[model samples]
Target: MMKKLENFAIQDFQNDLINWYRNEKRDLPWRKNQDPYKIWVSEVMLQQTRVDTVIPYFNEFTTKFPTIQALANADEEEVLKAWEGLGYYSRVRNLHSAVKEVNECYGGIVPNDPNEISKLKGVGPYTKGAILSIAYNIPEPAVDGNVMRVMSRILSIWDDIAKVKTRNLFEEIIREIISQEYPSDFNQALMELGAIICTPTSPSCLLCPVREHCAAFHEGVQTELPVKSKKKKPVPLQMAAAVLYDENGQLYIHKRPPTGLLANLWEFPNCELKQELNKTHTEQLALFLKEEYDIEAALQPLIGTIQHIFSHRIWNLSIYFGEIKSMESEKLVQVDEETIKQYAFPVSHQKIYKMYKGEI
Candidate 1:
C-alpha cells in the first residue's frame, strides 16, 4: 500500500502550497486566463523547454495562431515556422493534428473528459492531467518531472522517478492529496514549488511555503529523495552537408520525409559520413547529391561546422559550399535567402544559411 498523509496534513500542505502559489506565481501569459486552448499550447511548448525561453515563442505562437480553430486551419509549414527553433518538431506536428481533430469532432471545444482528451495525439498522462485540473478544475494529477520532484520531497517518495511505475504512484498520491477546491492552483503550486523552491539540486528549503510539511526536508535528505536513473549520453554523429547553390545564387533545399525525426523540415542536402566507404566528407557529399538527387556538384572547402544536440543524438555537421553542375530530380527547390525564409529549416540548416552569409 502507498503511504498516505493524515487528513490534517494533506489539508495543510494544500493550503500552504495554494496560498504561496497565489502570492508567488509568476505572471505568465498562459496563467492570464483559463482558456483551454492557450493552456494546451503553453503546456506543449513548455515541454523540455525553459519558461524564459518559451515566453517569446509562446507569445508569437499564440499571437499567430490564437485559437484551436486558427491553429487547426493553419498550414503545416506555417505551424512549423512558428515552432522553428523550439526543436522537437513532432510536438507541434502532433499538436497540430490533434487540434484539427478537436476542431472537426468536438466543434473546437477542448474535451474536458479525461478519456476523450487522453485520446488526442500527443496528449499523454502529464498533459492530460494538466489540462483537466488546470483548465477544468478537475482533481487530476499533473505529475511531470517538476511535480514528481516536489511530491517526492514533500512526501519523501524515494522511488526511481525515471520509471513509469513511480510516476503512476505519484499520480495516485497526488489524487489523494490534490485540493479539490482549488485544483488549478494546487497543480500549478506543485510545479511552481519544484521550479522555484524544491529544485533538483540544493532546493530552497528555507523559502518553501510547505517546508513544515516536507518529509524530505525534515529528514534532511531533500536532494537525495527523488531518485532518477541517469540517461545514456547522446550518440555523436558525423554528417556532411552541402550548401549547393545554382547559377542564379539560389540555395538548394529539400523537405525531410513526412515522418520520423525532423520530419517535413527543410534542410540543405546532407548525409551521414560513412566511415566504411573510405570517402572524404566532400566526396561523400558528392556521392549523396548524385545518388539522392541525380545531380552532380563541384564540392568546395568547408565553410565551418555546426553542432546541434538532440535528446539522444548529436549532429556534428561539416558544411561545404558547392555549385550545382547538373540537375535531374524535380524534388529540390532553389531559393534566395528571402525566399528561403518562407520555408522552415531546422536550426542546423539555419546555421548553414548564416555560415553561407559569413554571419557566423
Candidate 2:
C-alpha cells in the first residue's frame, strides 16, 4: 500500500508562492477585505463560475446586500433577481437560508468555526474550510479543484481525482502538509499555483516556481496527473415565454412554479412547446392563452428573442407585449413583496426589468 506524500517544506512553499502571488495574483474584489460574510458570499457565487464572469455580479450583490442581516431579511425574489443568469439557483436559495441561520445563530456575524459554518445549507468541507481559514485565520486547508490539481501533480498521484474517496485522500495529504505559521496563505498559494501554472490541460512548468518539487513534472506527466471523469451533455428542452402587457402599460408576467427551474421568478406567459414552432410564434402564443387561460389579446413583438442557458436546460424565449382587451388581472399571479423575493430568474428578464423598473 502506498502512503501519501506527507513531508514538504510547507513554509518555504508558502513563502515562495506568496512572493509570486504578490506579482501575479488577480485583483479580485473579494481579495480586498477579510470580511467573512463577503468571503462566504463570493465563494458561494464563484462555485463553477469564472472570476471575470463573477466580478460584476459580486460587486452588485455586495453593494445591494451589504451584510448578512440584509441578505437574511431580503425577499427571495430580490436574491434571485440578483442571482439571475447565474446557474445553480439552489446556491442562491441555500445562501439565503444560511444567512438567516447566521443572523439567528451567529448573531449577524458569520461564525469562525469550520464545523459550525459547514452545518449551513450549501456549505461543504471546502467552503467551510475556506471561510474559516481565509476570513478568520483558522488553520484549515481549503482544497478546491485548483488545490487538488496542484496536489495531484505535485505528489504524482495517478488515481482519478474525480472520485470522492480519491479527493478525500488528497485532502488528507493537504491536511498533513498545511503549515502552522501561515496556513491560509499556504492554502491559497496551492490553489493559485494550480489555477495559473499547473493547469489541467497544459501546465506551464517553466513558469511554476515549485516545478523542482513537483513529482509529475520530473516524470514528464505534469499535464496528466489529475485525471477527471467525463461530463455528460446537458439535456435540451423546448421552453417558451411571452411578455404580456395591456394599454395601462403594466406588463402581464406570470409567476413561475414555486419550485424547480427559476422557481417563483416572473416570466411572460410562457408555454412548453410540445411540438416544434409550427406557426408564427406570436400567433401560437395568442392561441395558447385562448386555450389555457381563456383570454385573447392583440400580441405584438417588442422585446427581442432571448436565450438563457442553465446548467441542465436551455430556455429559448420569444417576448412580445400583448395589448389585451380591458380586463382585470384575475388570472395573472399578483407579485407582492413577500412572494416576489425568492427564486432566480433568467438574466434577460432581469435586465429588462432593471431597465424598466422605474417605469413599471
**TM-score for each prediction?**
0.97, 0.83
Q: Give the winner by TM-score.
A: 1
RMSD of each: 1.3, 4.2
Inter-residue clash pairs, candidate 2: 75-341, 76-341, 76-342, 77-341, 77-342
The segments of candidate 2 whose C-alpha lies over 4 angstroms from its true place after superposition are: 6-15, 276-287, 300-305, 318-321, 326-344, 348-360
- Predicted candidate 2 versus true structure: per-residue lDDT over 86-192, tens digit per residue: 76778888999999999998899998876678889999988988888888878887878898888888888877777888878877887777767677677777877
Give the range of the ten consecutive residues with the poorest summed lDDT in model 2.
Answer: 334-343
Indicate the residue-level lDDT of 263 in model 2.
73
| Cα-lDDT of candidate 1 | 0.90
> In model 1, which residue pairs have backbone atoms overlapping below 3 Å?
none
For this target, which candidate reaches the highest lDDT against the unseen true structure? Answer: 1
**lDDT to native, each model:** 0.90, 0.76
Model 1 lowest lDDT segment of ten: 1-10
Per-residue lDDT over 1-360 for candidate 1, one digit per residue giving the tens place of the 0 to 100 score: 344565338877888889999999999999999999999999999888999989999999999999999999999989999999888889999999999999999999999999999999999999999999999999999999999898888777778999999999988888888898999999999999899988889999999999998888889999797899999999999999988888889888899999988999999888999789988888888888889999988888887888999889999999999899899997898888688888888888889889988899
